[model samples]
Target: MEDSRDPQFASLSVGDSAVAVLVDRATDDADVIHDIELMTCSEYSHLCLGMPSDDTGDLAMYTNNKEMHAEDRLALWPAFHRDRLAADGRRFADEGYDFVVQHQVGSRFVDYMNHVGESTFGTPMPESLSVVEKFANTATTSHYLVLHQALMERRIPRGSKILMVPAASGVVTGFLSATVSSLEV
Candidate 1:
């Protein structure tokens, strides 16, 4: 569905006077999450990413047997991004945002350290051994953080609407890599 009310967005065209806010789901993917951090280091970019927190108590839905802990939540990043990124990418490009803000996953919990094996000299490695397994989770957090900073810097107007294009078509159409202007003009 196309959203027409919001002025601030990620990838659409902002009228000469309108303020565009480009929001990317930073924690959505590993590559894009990395990109956000690279972009941020160069200069203070105006963008925002939404960070998922336990505030909603929805984390429980992810893990059925155990209460959703921080580690469990981190594990969900890859699937979450795989599920959501394409749609969001389309939104940013189609939205013509003036600024982009997003976040990727950040540090993990101590419990997550189990992934790593026994440390050298009887000391245990602080983190998981197969950190690659956690990359998606951490990346998700990174994206969220980067995007959050971006949003805070360039706050979108309260009433600005967001347009989210469906994912199935975006993936089918090869729209993921295209920038905001590249979308159907």
Candidate 2:
């Protein structure tokens, strides 16, 4: 797999069963990403959701057109399954684990979600296929959430650690947002 990381400045770590991980940090080189020592596999878990960067931006902006108000933005969000997305975030929390959504900012999902909201609603919006392109980056993020929940339901202990590698920063942030919302102080 060439480790999927650049060879020149990459690092490595061998964990249980000889699991090898290569980390590509903000730096131009790879750093050895090791197990989060403070946490255990049973205490924490991660979901790596993909964040699509194609249409979410334009759609969100188009949905929240300059003329739209907060109420309007809110309206469009639910229209394009924004509630469903939020619900998905809730789902991760219900299972007692945090998520790590990774997606690039400036991309569709991030761009709009970051500002106004998702469109895909209204009387005559874009087709489902076009809307889906915006979510391409989110598949991995959602997958991680689902998997994390499943593991916790099976009694994965709190503080256990799970690794979500090579996903967009947005995905990781989404997961964290979901987790924070679900936990009680």
Candidate 3:
């Protein structure tokens, strides 16, 4: 765009303009539970990785209990989702995007992006970690924060596509894929 945009949203989409959302965290439980940060950090991470075990039989026991909060199953969910993203990047490249966002998983999330880019596509990965560094994460909006950060800096390529990954407890995870439609925002 030829006009200036709000600095806070430079690297992110302007509502439905950039992002095409498929799902939202709207459910009947949303009306009843307002405070979701009810658990300790360790307990939260445990939802993704179940308690450790030494014996195969013990592990199987965990598997039987409603999937036992099965560590392997829970762990594989994220892996499978992330692994397929590289292929998504590849397929979307022809559309002028290089898969330039939404690789976060933790502090090492950026590292994972570069690693996957190298192993899967033989290219250097772009980082979106500055979103949290510049402006702290707001639960589900972290991905947008990074996107906006990139846009504010004019780091994102105009018309290029980007990806946003958001995860929640109860094993809920999501992805938002969008194209940069404006240089101003």
CA lDDT of every candidate: 0.25, 0.27, 0.42
Question: Which residue runs does candidate 1 get wrong by more than 4 Å?
Answer: 1-68, 83-185
TM-score of 1: 0.18
Q: What's each prediction's TM-score?
A: 0.18, 0.18, 0.44
87-179: candidate 1 lDDT, tens digit per residue: 456222233323321121123332342221122112332211122223433322332333333345444333232221111101110111212
lDDT of 2 by residue, 1-185 (tens): 13322221111111102222232343321222222211112111122112232433321101111222234332343333334445456321233222222222124543444233223322222111111233333333333433334454543333323223222211112122211112111
Q: lDDT, candidate 3, residue 53?
A: 39
Q: After superposition, how far is residue 41 of candidate 2 from its true place, in Å?
A: 38
RMSD for each of the candidates: 19.3, 19.3, 16.1
Off by over 4 Å in 3: 1-96, 103-106, 113-129
Candidate 1 lDDT for residue 141: 31
At residue 140, candidate 1 shows an lDDT of 24
